[model samples]
Target: MEAFTTHTGRAVPLRRSNVDTDQIIPAHWLKKVTRDGFEDGLFEAWRKDEEFILNRPERQGATVLVAGPDFGTGSSREHAVWALQNYGFKTVISSRFADIFRGNSLKNGLLTVVLPQRTVDALWELTEADPTVEITVDLVARKVTAPGVEADFELDENARWRLLEGLDDISITLRHEEDIAAYEAKRPSFKPRTLTV
Candidate 1:
């Protein structure tokens, strides 16, 4: 997981509510155990529509996703977060989010910002009117800001620290590697044994 601090980029506005994990990344994509390359499967069904925002060339390389209420609201698949990260979205702004999905996103260093519905609607409208609109997510200040709007958001302190440090679960565990090694070395009853006793 890459560390997330302040990110400013073109925003990808997904103006729909109740976006479930299955809709973000369908179940068939879960067959691969590896975490790389889920971007292809991200919103696979939605892409078939040809008019989906993700298909718009102007939105390419957008690092922020401005979405509607109750985003990421489905099965507890962490792949939804993976898909977003692989697809290069560093931050997601919404009116609300599913608890489990939010947690998973934080664990993977994907920033999920919950702003009031009014703020979200404003962003959606701006992005819709102009594809060049960009938003900045300042994690250090816990704020999201656009040309004519600014709002405060909240995140868990520990999650914020983990993202700032780009520390995943394994990285956290490795921080205590020396202590673990010493504990194993001190285990009792480790003498060599003879074939016959």
Candidate 2:
């Protein structure tokens, strides 16, 4: 997983609520275990519609997604996060998110921002009014800011630190590899003698 620190980029405003995992990448796309190339499946169903937010060229390569409430609900597939990353979304801002989805997203280095409904609506409106509008997510400060809005938020200290350093769970554990090796070296290795019966 790539580390996340501060990201600033064009915003893609998705006003729909209750976007589930299946809608994110669909079940068929799950056949592949590798995380690469799932961008084709990101919002597969919605992308079919000519008017979907993602279909607009202005939103292409957008790194920040301003979405509605209850985002990433329904299923617990980590693929949802994978699809978002593959589709070039680095940060997701919404009024709320499913706990499991949020955890999965963080584990994959996708920053999920939880803000008040009013603030979310404001951002949605602002971005909609201007397709080129940009937003910034500052992990260190735990804040999301735009032209007229600045909202402070919270995240687990450990998660925040991990993202700032671009370290995933495995990378974090590997940081203590030397200590683990030393401990294993100190432990006595013994084989039990077989008892003749």
For this target, which candidate reaches the highest lDDT against the unseen true structure? 1
Cα TM-score per model: 0.85, 0.85
Residue 145, model 1: Cα distance from true site in angstroms: 1.1
lDDT of 1 by residue, 1-197 (tens): 78889999998889899999999999999999998899999999999987899988999989999988999998999999999999999989998999999999988889999999999989988888887888999999998888898999988788888888888788679999999999988878666668647
Runs with alpha carbons beyond 4 Å of true place in candidate 2: 171-197
Tens digits of per-residue lDDT for model 2, 1-197 = 68888999999988888878788889999889897889999999889998898999988878998888889987888888998998899999988998899999998889999999899988988999998888999998889989999999988898888788877687678989999999988877573448744
Model 1 stretches with alpha carbons more than 4 Å out: 170-197
RMSD to the hidden true structure, all candidates: 5.5, 5.1
Model 2 TM-score is: 0.85
lDDT at residue 192 of model 2 (Cα atoms) = 46
Model 2 per-residue lDDT at 116: 96
Residue pairs with backbone overlap in model 2: 3-166
lDDT of 1: 0.90
